[model samples]
Target: MPEIRPRSTIVVTLLCIAGLAVAGVALAYCVHLGAQRDDDTGQSAAEFTYIPPNQAGLAADDVTPESDEVPEQLDTVRSKIMLCTIDKIGTDVLSVHTPDGRKHQLTLSPDTHVESAKGNEVADLTTGDLVVVRVIESDTATTVDLIVDGRVSSSIPDN
Candidate 1:
């Protein structure tokens, strides 16, 4: 039989309370982060809008060009961002299949940056990860930028 000391009981109670407080703080922080990520995802998804090929010219006509704009500079590059599913991941490339039924092998360089919700690196990317890739093409060379994990937004209508 162990003697029940009031001082020992108080210490144990305080420790339990402290543990609960820490757990509560951690839970709150996690919730806050989740909300923040949701907000970011919403904003990013809104940036992409689908336009049918037939309406491409009509959509372009709606925008007026600025006459004051200077000619294209040497550093000017064309870039496209696409949402795709990873079919395979390699040391310096990623094989992805797009919703358009096209498979592509995107080259990765030392400068390529990969991101995910878990703060993962390029090596952490696995097969079948939905990702958004930015491909930039210039007269001299083509390069890729950020490859970030993504989700299909409900706002986007299914084909």
Candidate 2:
């Protein structure tokens, strides 16, 4: 009986070690697959949001994507195109209200340009300023250009 006990313990320990090795290999393989998804490889699948077809009698061309804003995964902000009133301003952001009173906040990065009508610094812009802001829409204003009095006053990034 003592001999049988020792044999059983050896078998159990060997089985446990083999199982752990298999688990480690599976974990490494899963991480590799996840890395592939982030690459631009053809092996990656197309990412899309699900919606019923022809829900609003609109064609695919006219239909908006599930998300109209720039994806958060992007490090750069996008741009927008519209005329709106500067609703509010803070240290690093500005809120612009549309003609219909819909407000959107524009983000300012360290690279954002703040200029005046004659190529000077627009140090202060007020809440009532009428502006046409061309924007690339992320969660915040990624790329934004402020047009005042029918001229480009400020824009994000020189290019």
Candidate 3:
């Protein structure tokens, strides 16, 4: 019913362009956040186990000459064993098999991590690769430290 105005049409077009720009920026930011979350998920898997520091023979330090001597508690040593490989290495954890034919899962600690030799040789390992690993026993759970220097031999059986 009213006459068409060129100035009003121009203003409306500019506002529509500004709204589209804002929406595009928001979508890009959301995608970046999702990628960051995926990267952090592998790091959190390291918390599965921890070893406590040695604290034996502390009470004996407070004893005086006149007082009765207190017996010091002996520290218990943990055993290290070879873990059998059951599957391929992942971003954070490795699947293994125990000597008793039971399945066990292990994780790589931040301090004790794995590296590939010969340009991504470790990454090429597939399921049924034979790998020797060292593990430490802790109160909370068992922690894997190092991978014994070797490659997956063909003699090992597949899971």
Candidate 4:
């Protein structure tokens, strides 16, 4: 009925374009957040391998103890003893403290298995829980295999 005003048409077009720009930005941010969450999930899928103390040069034959001379294989030893404080316990990974008082983060992958007589203790672990973790150094970082005793209070004391 009434004539369409040129100024009104321009204003409407500008408002529509601004709304679309805002929506685009919001969508991009959501995608970025999703990608970050996926990255964390991938990290938790790392595998673990156990290296015996003898093979790693930490311990010689139990029956026959070698002299104090360090073996040549010690240079290749990729595992270490670490006392850590549980900073965070996630669905997959665990944040721990290194012996030097620095925080060393460790991942709990599907292959990163744990052996504990104490059941469900892993899930109930809280921040500040002290744990002695045996970790094998890898290309990316160290991966935990055995939870050494004397750290977790819930564990039964060794005879």
Candidate 5:
């Protein structure tokens, strides 16, 4: 018959090797996962996560279920509004200087809103007039609203 020590030693060594092989595979898989980078940010599917501005809850690392609903578009439109003073005015052109001394010559849309302290028209606009200009910009159209002297006078919407 066979010697017991040789058979037992062979079996123990084989088992130990198999166990080590499994452990090595598990460690390699863990390292692979750790080396992965997150490239899903700024994608439309993950954009506009509905986290309100200045609201605190549910950080990006929190696990979330996969949603089938269409993601909302982020507000990349109407990104800024500036209060500017009229530097120059013309029939088809309007120039304004912002408080930071940057000047912009805006093309006058046929439907541009020209408002003032009094019920005034574009011809009534004069140099040094303080105007609140709400600029609307989209992929196709750019328009502006001219509100003079803080009166709720006129607006340029969706044009």
Candidate 6:
């Protein structure tokens, strides 16, 4: 049997304590973030539900566990909804600018749905129209699922 050195034991004890301290700090930070409130809705930020990209058109209550368990497509990532102004239009693509001043070029999927006061087709959309877009992002592509003209919808909040 070999003798245990006092220095080795001290070093091991100090490493264990440091690891515990780091873990505690990380847990406290997560709790703090979860407790933070969203000023606009007067709700906790953590309460926001993560809607899957394929189900962006569905209401929060409409999403079912059965659907969520099986994704429609593979390699698809997260989804997001944005209020954007149409900057430019193409045959199958759109360039839009968000309120935050960022510009994005969006491609419409073959089955993309468009709702507007003017018409339901993509040809009816014009430049400078405010639209609420629900988009699904993937590693290989960014696809638009739904587009609603903000003028006809009360969903767009007033500043």
Question: TM-scores for all candidates?
Answer: 0.46, 0.38, 0.38, 0.41, 0.42, 0.50
lDDT of 6 by residue, 1-159 (tens): 998778988999999999999999999999998798756677676575556677778775774777566444555488999999999988778789999999998888788899998899888999999999999888777788999999944566684
9-69: candidate 1 lDDT, tens digit per residue? 8999999999999999999998777555345345543265554444465644475346523
For candidate 4, give the lDDT.
Answer: 0.67
Model 4 lDDT per residue over 37-88, tens place: 3444454334433454554655435343465444555545388777778888
Overall local distance difference test of candidate 6: 0.85
C-alpha RMSD (angstroms) for model 3: 18.4
Candidate achieving higher lDDT, 1 or 2 = 1
Q: Model 1: which residue pairs collide?
A: none
Q: Give the winner by lDDT: 2 or 6.
A: 6
Off-target runs (Cα >4 Å) in candidate 6 are: 1-76, 153-159
lDDT by residue (tens digit), candidate 3, 17-36 = 99999999999998777655
Name the candidate that leads on lDDT.
6
Clashes of 1: 0
Candidate ranking under lDDT, highest first, comes to 6, 1, 5, 4, 2, 3
Clashing pairs in 4: none
Q: Please give the lDDT score for candidate 5.
A: 0.70
lDDT of 5 by residue, 18-59 (tens): 999999999999887766657745444324345544444667
TM-score winner? 6
On a 0 to 1 TM-score scale, where does candidate 3 land against the true structure?
0.38
Please report, in order, the local distance difference test score of every candidate based on alpha carbons: 0.76, 0.64, 0.61, 0.67, 0.70, 0.85
Which stretch of 10 consecutive residues in model 5 shows the poorest summed lDDT? Answer: 40-49
Clashes of each: 0, 7, 0, 0, 0, 0
Q: Per-residue error at 158 for model 6, in Å?
A: 27
On lDDT, the stronger of 3 and 6 is 6
Measured over all alpha carbons after superposition, the RMSD of each candidate to the real structure, in angstroms, is 19.7, 17.6, 18.4, 19.6, 19.1, 14.8
lDDT of 2 by residue, 1-159 (tens): 343566788899999999999999999998777656655655545454444453456665775766654455647565557788877777777777889978777775555555446543334566676766666676633555554433554577976
- Whose TM-score is higher: candidate 2's or candidate 5's? 5
